[model samples]
Target: MLAWPAWLTILLLVTNLLSLAALFFVTRRMLKLRRQKKRAFAFSDYPVRKAKLEEIAPCFAMSGYGPSPDSEVRFIGGEGVVSSLSDRESWVMAALAKGVKRVFEFGTCSGKTTHVLALNAAPDSEIFTLTLHPDDLAATEFGFGDDREHRDIALSESSFETFYYNGRSSERHIRQIFSDSKSYNEAPLRGSVDLVFVDGAHTRSYVENDTRKALNMLADEGVILWHDYKPGVPGVFAFLNELSRTLPLVHIADTDLVMYRRVRKQLSPA
Candidate 1:
């Protein structure tokens, strides 16, 4: 091989170093996808909700959300939190078991909680889960093998980026639609969305914004679930303020979660 001049050789070395840096960046992302967290379901040892299928059908019928069947979901938050999953996870399932017409969730962390909900949904009902993982790796990383078939979690990872400014996310690369505003061209879904659960962000502004976005999507008769309503989270309490006092809402049955129904009459009853 011919030897290069001193200055030219230095330039070549710099180029090589830059290329290495780029390669490392790509590799780090791949590793993140495979990385598994040590966090356990706060209620790992607690009993799973066991509402009989018969009990869940009626909630959906009354809600008029759509064709929601019986369903439940499991979530992992701070330690000992899910021990019984408190109301954040349970109350919704109880409602789902009551036969809510549809199920919608944000933040598909580890696929456990959403999976719980999907398993119980009525055969005709559907469960939709929004996750941070992209559409491509969703099947490979989040898919828990044969167990996934029944859950029917229509995955939507797009919203995580747009609504959250997930600029570097794979959603941009793959061109997927994550939010209804995107799908409907900056318009909300036609008609109304049945139920919405937003748990993706924990910060006050983030959670508050998500709540507003969900509100616009739900059917007038729909309900929305907000996670991380415990003490210390600024946004939880602030977001709650946006709701009218007369709206029908319940604090987490036994936990710090919160829920609201979309009844306009309840928005402000004198």
Candidate 2:
């Protein structure tokens, strides 16, 4: 057979390149769709506790379900802030705060949640929130064990220069700890906190570290809440998924919050 013409050979090469480019784009699109579906599926893995807003308030109680009288609660928030808690979540947290005496927050993005906690907690309650100042980014030290994706997210969300509670009355109740959570010691907080909110870094390593310390810092009957466990947050979702298997966790329906309660064990029969 005669050799192919130079023009034909050049055209065939270009066609192959175009075909490969199209295949690459199509494959990428499919992978993205798969990831979206996977994230949606993650929220369905745990049980959701559904209740009317009023039903969950600290004051509305029946025979077996009512907050203790000492538990005082008040909710404050809903200014359309992207980083703040949703109205329903704020209410749930406020009701829970009625029973909390010492609260710890892993991240204090704008201090909106912290303000809400202080507003609802007992009059003499105290709050400790950990976060990095915008100025400390250069000096911050993150965990080495975190996955690359998680570490990147944690770094991106670490800045906290302005806060809602900066001059508010609630500020009096809050003790802000400015430091990278990885290097922060848990010794002073161990076994004394009544509520811990893990909303700091979205990385797996940071989540694991914060969770371990939260458990250690928790009082015998304390509660822990983690945020951003919904779709698109892979690190938070993945870690909580593995954790929920062995720990008692309940997802609050229509929200991205998961709660774990440490129940006090009863003494053996006398």
Per-model tally of clashing residue pairs: 25, 0
* lDDT (C-alpha) at residue 217 in model 1: 72
Q: lDDT of each model, Cα atoms only?
A: 0.48, 0.79
lDDT of 2 by residue, 19-99 (tens): 999999999999999999998775445434434333433353543555444334576655576466887678667778774
What lDDT tens digits, residue by residue, belong to model 1 across residues 5-74? 8999899999999999999999998777655332244333222232332333353343366434433333
Query: Largest TM-score belongs to which candidate?
Result: 2
TM-score of decoy 2:
0.73
lDDT of 2 at 73: 53
Q: Candidate 2: worst 10 consecutive residues by lDDT?
A: 49-58
Candidate 1: stretches off by over 4 Å: 1-88, 134-191, 242-246, 264-270
Candidate 1: RMSD to truth: 20.7
TM-score of each: 0.46, 0.73
